[model samples]
Target: MSKRMLALACALALLLTACNESARPQPSEGAAEIWFAVGTGEDGGPLVDGGGAVAPEYRALPDEADPVEERMAALLSGPQSAELRSPFPSGVRLRSWRLEEGVLRLDLSEAYGGLSGVDLTIADYCIVLTLCQVEGVEAVDITVEGETVPYRGRKLMREGDVVLSGGEGEPVAITASLYFLRRSGGLASESREVLVTENDTLATAVMGALMAGPRDQEELYLPLPEGTELLSAAVEAGVCYVNFSRAFTEGAPQSREEAARLLYAVVDTLCSLDQVEAVHLLVEGESLDRYGGVPTRNPLEKDYEMAGEEKPAAASGS
Candidate 1:
């Protein structure tokens, strides 16, 4: 094993070493259901349930083997049914696994890193939904060769986080209070009516509008740079985690005043939502210690002082 892999193994061991064995669920004696990506329909045609589609097949657990390990191995081994397929690449192997509390962490060989986007999502949840069936497991955290996939949607995935269905509600018109840069400086709220469909979240809709820039460009400045796109946005607790594409940084404002405005415009806009009290921003799914001269090491609360007639504040010493 490489040094990185060895380090990860040692860390995993240390984390789980003191865990009570009795707390971990033992493998059942009979067949256990293992999940696989749904490749085709019964008629030998392609599936159109979006790329994260999956189905399950039952396989017996070895009497004397580790249940979690066995389940992972079966998943990596691919499916026996003709209509199902393995989400893992051919060469990927499960190197190590450990369970602590209710979280199961699995470290796989390098080949697993090849999956991304919807393919990665399907592969990940295939493991998650499969293992979550075990008595003690409530969530699954996966790493490829001991390193987290940089752009994967979430760090720890739990069941019910995703639902595979075909129904979408009609678009309903709702007004969102979005923040945009003032022509002179600082930020101001713009109340606009936005349509939200079943696929849209209010936070996401607000973000999309922010990224689209202000409709009246002459009156208000676009805080987010041209070409910026919102990758994902969701609220957990009171913090809204917002992930943006690479264009956000590439086209970012160079001036400190504009950067501060850009950062808080997102923060204040999302905070306007009832569920979100703060904003955690990310570029290309990775956290940054600083965005230009702005400190982004923590989730930022809505700074009312940065809004309206007020000018952008000076850089913080902390």
Candidate 2:
């Protein structure tokens, strides 16, 4: 993996490793049901209610075989509710599956590439959440017709691009306060309860959940682009340094005001963390003072609030 990708993965894994201060609820030991992040309603986006394990006890399979493949079979069955949906459509089939090191490698039919935009987003999460439940699997690598499909950018999702999903055996739940832009102004804080792995750091999971947006509410907006990667991150003292792929700062926001909102949506979300009193935003690993004229320097104090506020015409600073 490239240093950038490795750094990002380390950021996420380290988050889970470090955040063990308080007691975290363990995942269900008897995982009776598995959850898949499937698309719901016409405009409901992705909701985790898809498949609930094909067999009552997947861990007790009689034969010594690939357990991940068995879970994939259940996922292929699709969501029980008509309101929910899966990415594995009519022509899409799991051509093959294997587990290497900690990554679950998935090869699907060409039809898998048929999904795009929001549909693709829902589908990707569905597969990731479903398969990552198996033991020894830490991440998933997906391919279509033997080729790596370009997901959010030219860099195929080989590492950090992987979506962190809830495992089947059990789920760790935590509440986080994520910030979003409100039409009325002022950075609005929304408290969200999210499920993550035992190894997942609250900070990384919160960022992941933030990127997923405030669920069940349409008013709040996701600050980053669809394919943006949380390149790398670390929390020190009171400052949280989060790095994103180029996709974040490229193709600038429509205007300066919009840019400020985007920047704070990120700042406010991270600042919500008890350990984080400031936020430092970076693209790749470089600290950008400004992107397309939007001030993104960090150690961005809580007082530099986005709520009921707007950036000055000459907005620029950390």
Candidate 3:
């Protein structure tokens, strides 16, 4: 071959080699993993010495020298004051935390109680929002003790009791207060003498009230859209059948997931009652399974044993 032809052939061979190399599977930059020493917040900042297991790859995030627990505590304690108080008290104790891929795993202590439907919703939003605010975190998995709270009706990790269903009834007459977050700073509290009753079936009572109450008014239970009406509710076997007028279906603006969430809300409310084992979504006196594709098992259904299953009379943190 001529010198020019030889050079051309060499260039083609190099290009082919490059293509072959590109085609070969390259190992992942591997999932970024980091270890954050858990720390408690003192007057200054997180008191970190340097001793903690490395966070799993799925729960790992961008490297930070600060203790993860202390940072999380500060974040929870900061501007989102109202968000944390919905379950009642203003204390959230972190048991553990890990980060891998884009998900943050947060293990909370049982001290974070008094959580209700609204309160749990607040907690969900708070954790997701807070973690996603961090540069690398895209999602969060929250667990109490060693059990994980199932989100969107599926157990991503190990099983744990979702407080969404099954609570105990302890009638306590305490001065009820509502707190709203101010744009400026701190929470604005309004005191009212409302009877606070805790019952495994209390959520059911709230759902019943929502189903029976006026559609035009706003209450603690049913937060309806522009034009929705509750038709009826009945308990059959273990299922609580909740029926709503066509207006309830037509007037409410909800996506598939949102509708599922709404259904879970209702189910969570009702299933908290000992008498009701599950909930059936209905519209215009028919099961939503035929029309709306509502799942037979709603979001609140979980496999984990409840917090007080073994010890029936265990008092929840107030």
Q: Judge candidate 2 at residue 168 and give its lDDT.
A: 45
lDDT at 314 for candidate 2?
A: 33
lDDT of 2 at 169: 34
Residue-wise C-alpha lDDT for candidate 1, range 1-28, written one tens digit per residue: 4433222212201010111234323445
Error of 3 at 157 (Å): 12
- The TM-score values for the models, in the order shown, are 0.44, 0.44, 0.31
Candidate 2: list runs displaced more than 4 Å.
1-169, 292-294, 303-305, 308-318
- Quickly count the clashes in candidate 2: 13
Q: Pick the candidate with the highest lDDT.
A: 1
**Segments of candidate 1 deviating more than 4 angstroms:** 1-169, 309-318
Q: What are the per-residue Cα lDDT tens digits for candidate 2 across 3-74?
A: 443332223221112112132223455542333333222221222222211111122332455667666666
lDDT of 2: 0.54
Number of colliding residue pairs in each model: 0, 13, 13
Q: lDDT for model 1, on a 0 to 1 scale?
A: 0.66
